[model samples]
Target: MAKVKHESRWYPLESGESVLDGLLRQGVSVPHSCRAGACQSCLMKAVGGAVPQAAQVGLKETLVAQGYFLACTCRPPEGTELEVAGAEALRVPARISSLSFLAPDVLRVRLVTDAPFDYRAGQYVSLVREDGLARSYSLASLPREDALELHVRVIPGGAMSGWLAAEAPLDQRVFLQGPAGSCFYVAGRPDQPLLLAGTGTGLAPLYGIVRDALEAGHTGPIWLFHGARTPAGLYLRDELRQLADRHPQLRYRPGVLAGGTRDIAEGPLDALIRAECPKPVGWRAWLCGDPQLVLSLRKKLFLAGLSLKDLHADSFLPSTPQVGASPAAAGAR
Candidate 1:
């Protein structure tokens, strides 16, 4: 079993135990959520031993070179030593700039930071409250936008979302960590057909990605689909429609599983998408939203001739917090 050294103390891991579990078993106060290694809240560093390559997956090369690894996924070799990273090193302070409702249950949050924060659109950041509660939200604003925008779907008992929607004061300072994820738009394929699909606030990243592509002067045919159970679940319809109208290369399709209207299609969203693009051989697709839906669409797109290399996905998992309820659960992948 590997031994984890943290703050001058050593903890022994049981057979097949992860570094996070080993420390938590010994009553260590490590911040973590979405134990599946998606949230990246339990990030740590290996100072005296080699970290497992799997634990470094999805992390930036700079962080990996600096010895950072996800504790939740770390299961080092026998006799390996590690260290817990300080929270201060991983968080940057930002202040809330504005808030508004985009839908009945979705809140649009804008934040600004004096710190030099650089991020690509469609990436995600973890918002950490004063009390140590953290939840990941994706960026809906472009990099050049004046403020960072996040579309938060308020869950009934979500601690982070509820606080942001009801209690958080404007100008309240909060810590922001990470701008991870590779779902952002990449320029250079100006003429490649693009397909983007998302559900709920999953549209947040897709929204940013669409604008980013257009800003980069992409002349490709871009098809964007946003799905919801009802029309109320869909927001920004007019704004997206106006955008599509201004850009002849763009098309916006909004649909509902029920309550079909003259403007909105009614059917299984995945089926609707597949019917529209029966042969996606030369298409570059970006899928975001519920894990199950993203998984389904990924498989379908792959089977329909879309290359896996051209398909990017960011799947948000519902957070099952041990401390407090979080909206949309954990990791806005």
Candidate 2:
């Protein structure tokens, strides 16, 4: 017999259970979405212990060489102690119950999975379409229910978005790999403040954070800074307003980037985030948006005194084509 300790509770088993299942049973929060390990959402560090090279984790050769293994596929080898944290990961899988237009160019997609999808507020999923097309989207679903909602921003020459907008069926079977990134709310650390920066379709994940905070009863001050090229670029404004109305702890500021004459306002995002929460000393931040915005905010927040560990983010992306889909874009420099 072997002892499996997780989340402070030990589950003694004749055979070790899958690493993720054991962790969840013990209440240890490890970021994961696509349990199949295709999304790399379950990336975790093994403090001490070794896994068989041919065993189930399906880790890449490079990652295995670095001692990186998948917790979703972990099986203990007698007397194994595990230590995992919320790092760069998130994901969830659900069906499109409905898709509506929030703006002419922005989409509001509602999804509900057959299984219970557990994810932090700021996490997101990769929406997959027929013909091997994929789109990265953040969950707008509130913590109040199991249904997942996502805000989608279509880009020109994108296959997934066009199919989702015009051809994808409501009941069609599409696969998703997520609750996949490190972007999310941290309620346990309520002693520190929280800053949420959103741009364009980025409101999807931010909305999730606000709902989770309200539900978890985090009393700390929350500053939300959202930016868009025009008011039209701001998806779910009405929903955000409703969220603000419901929670006194949440304060939201909407900024339009196009209206700028003063030298101070380089962009709407820069103005809103810098003006309100100028310092990130003890606060935790969740940022989701265009890659440029995500990268810039991470840099700026660090400069403002926030430790690298304190900042979490997910860079939004458009539909990626597989078979007739366009090639993957180059990694940002």
Candidate 3:
């Protein structure tokens, strides 16, 4: 028998039962999704007692260093003490400024915080609605921008997406938690060729990161691959094309799955990247959008010569009870 602590309450952790399961059994509504640990929706911090190393697997170094572990995977020993993160450290109060359709299925949302909030371009934040349901969305706006921008794709039957698309009102106040993940571009790597790829709305973070790189005066060639199932699914196509035309160092390639359009490359997005840059030995890669695409491309790019250290990604898992399938408004991003 083990006493597991969350907040001020103590719950019994039966032997062989996971922390998430035990907590849920006690009616403790700790947010969680993908109970297998891939979504990071059940993240918890150890307040006292030793945290099992296995519980922190696949977490970012910064999170691991901060004593954060996934509750869904935590099979702790007896007497383990835990604490859910406080809202203050993880949440920022903000209000929605405006929402616009980027595509038939995608909406661009902007949020203005009460105070200055700092975050890298490629990081993501969890948007919590009035009902207490929350969903993760990548920030498409840069830190210097006046408002936080998120590109959301409507997913069929998704609660948060449906709410944002049909129910959320203007000037709505929402709590935003996080700017987490280490997939952003850093200044020191200016000389390294950057390869960015995404499917559907995955372009949100990739768009922000690309702008950040350009603003930092990156001298190396910068390539971006955006893929969609059809031309109508491609949001910001004209804008990205204009950006490419303006920056000689930047290259934008649009990939389409069904029809072979002259303006867009035909094939899977990962295949598009493979064809463009066969040897990515010294390149740094950023991938977002669908989880399968991100995972498969990560492996493929690594095998194609990109250093494992140089590759970064944010996989949007399908939205579940406590987990979000990133960019919940349209296509995978």
Candidate 4:
């Protein structure tokens, strides 16, 4: 049997048991989500003993070099020692500045951090509650902005979204971790044609990226496509339209699967995009939204001539609605 040590405590791991399971079975509280390791909420650092390569799969090279591994996936050898990475060091304290409904199910949250929170537009952060419940949301505001903006979809029975929509008060303090993901605008690519697409609240990061590109004085044409199942799901229509009106180089297209108006494209989003840009060679693209949809579009766009290196994507899992549940456990969007 392998044994794991954390702080001053020792926990015995059952044969073939993972570090997370061993600690949890011994009544140790460790934050975790998506036990399968997708959420990265169960991140822990190995202080002693070699971490299994499998436990660090999908982690960034920097994190892996620093001995960080997903506790849920770490089945270390006998006598392994681990530590919960200092959560406070990674947390950026912020207070809710404002919240409003963008659509019936989407809440736009503005957070003002106590300290300068440096992050590129389109990166994501995990919002941690007082009880240690955390869920990841992308940044929809630029770094220069006074507040960080997040567009959260209020899923039925979603714990974090429900709190933000109904109970969280203005000035409520929350901690943020990360500014991770790699889908932001790069300033040097001023002349590269850009394609931005997403669905539902996935518009949040795309919105920020568009603004960032424009702010950087991008001279290339930017095509933005937003889709929803219905018109009601399409928030920020006027705002996006206004943005397009000001910038001749920017074109905004709104699509819907149902309830399409004369101004809105009526068809599948992927098909609409394919029809518009049949060959996206030499284009830079950013995609966000449902994992399946994003993955499918990525493949299609690559086959259509977009380079894999130039394509960036972020897939939002559905929100988990259970109180105190890990985002991965409930499916966090």
Report every candidate's CA lDDT: 0.85, 0.64, 0.81, 0.84
lDDT of 1 by residue, 1-333 (tens): 678888889889987788887887887777676677777766677777788899999898998988888888988777776665545587889999999999998899999988778999999888887766778889999989889999998876677787888999999998888988888888988999999999999899999999999999999899999999999988999999999999999989998999989999999889889878789898999999888999999999999999999999888876655433334443332
Candidate order by decreasing TM-score: 1, 4, 3, 2
Q: Estimated TM-score per prediction?
A: 0.93, 0.67, 0.87, 0.90
Q: For model 2, what is the error of residue 37's alpha carbon versus the real structure, in angstroms, after optimal superposition?
A: 12
RMSD of each: 2.3, 11.3, 3.6, 2.8
Backbone atom clashes (below 3 Å) for every candidate: 3, 13, 8, 3
Which residue ranges in model 3 land beyond 4 Å of their true spot? 6-8, 33-41, 45-50, 54-69, 79-89, 322-333
- Better structure of 2 and 4 per lDDT: 4
Q: Which residue pairs show backbone clashes in model 1?
A: 318-329, 319-329, 319-330
lDDT of 1 at 295: 95
Residue 161's C-alpha lDDT in candidate 2? 63
TM-score of 2: 0.67
**lDDT per residue (tens digit) for residues 34-129 in model 3:** 566655556777766666898898777887887888888888776665555423355678999998889999989999999788799989877777
lDDT of 2 by residue, 1-333 (tens): 445443345555346576766665555555443444444545555544565443324444555565666665667677665443322322234578988998887777788876677666666666655433345567777656767787776554445566677887897766565555666676586656888887777777888887787778888888877777776666666777787788777887777767643322336587577877777797888887777888898999999998888888776643222223245321110
After superposing candidate 1, which stretches have Cα over 4 Å from the reference?
323-333
**After superposition, candidate 2 runs with Cα above 4 Å error:** 1-94, 259-267, 317-333
Candidate 4 per-residue lDDT, tens place, 1-333, comes to 677778777678887889877777777776655566655666777776777899998777877888888887888775554444434456789999999999999899999999999899998887888777777788899999999999998875677788888899999999887767788998887989999999988899999999999999998999999999999999999999999999999999999998889999999999999998888999999999888899999999999999999999898865433344454346355
